[model samples]
Target: MLSEFKAFVMRGNVLDLAIAVIIGGAFATITKSLTDDVIMPVVGWLFGGFDFSSYFIRLGPIPESYAGSPTNYAALKEAGVPLFGYGEFITVTINFLILAFIIFLLVRYANKAMARFEKDEAPAADPADVVLLREIRDELKAQRGGQ
Candidate 1:
């Protein structure tokens, strides 16, 4: 059973998946930063300095201001208030779009690179071999004619 488990763990697909998961986690952080830090700020500036993260609808009695202006989502949820949270949704949607576009670009580049490599590595047909074979056939035809 231990050997079976070891074999399963050592398989190429499993290792590849593990590596992909780690890389995906890192990529998620990068996308999140791009959406929240870079893109959202620009978008907010365009909309007359409106921060999306703060644009939530308090379901119950609305507080004059949230305590310490809690930046984290969990804190807002814990405040015993149902919230719309559209700003966070917008940020998440932007991240997803950016990640999708990046993946599409990567796939396109990989396909182009594979095509170039295949073209370069293709075996060239020998013109000399073809000429030699034709000459042998012509010689055989001449001998048969003489006979």
Candidate 2:
């Protein structure tokens, strides 16, 4: 059972999937940072605010013990405030789009590369016996013509 498990884990597809997952996680983090740190800030500035993720509508009343500012979305949420955080959603959506676009481009190029490799392959050579037989047949035809 242990050997079977080891064999299953050591399969090429499984190893490839594991590596893809790790790479995908890192890529996702990069996409998230790009969305939050770069794009959102510019978008927020255009919308007349410096912080885009803080643009939320308060749904429920703040707790009596809560001392956070009313405009602080993260702080209010931490203090058990209900919020319609549309800015954060927008950021996440943009991140997903970026990641999906990158993956699509990668897959498209990879398929093109694979197709090129397949098309460039030379046809298989004939076996030694087949080559020898063809040579003998040509020699016999030549001898018959000469006679």
How many clashing pairs per prediction, in order? 0, 0
The TM-score of predicted model 1 comes to: 0.76
RMSD of each: 4.1, 4.8
- C-alpha lDDT of all candidate models, in order: 0.83, 0.90
Q: In candidate 1, residue 104 scores what lDDT?
A: 93
* Candidate 1 Cα misplacement greater than 4 A, ranges: 62-75, 129-147
Across 1-147, the per-residue lDDT of candidate 2 in tens digits comes to 999999999999999999999999999999899888888878778978867577799999999999878998889989989999997787788899989998999999999999989988967789999999999999999999999
In model 2, which runs have C-alpha deviations exceeding 4 angstroms? Answer: 124-147
- Candidate 2: pairs in clash: none
Give me the candidate number with maximum lDDT.
Answer: 2
- Report the C-alpha lDDT of model 1 over 20-118, residue by residue, as the tens digit: 999999999998898888988898899899777776766665355668444555577776557778877877787899999998999999999999999
- TM for candidate 2 is 0.77
TM-score of each: 0.76, 0.77
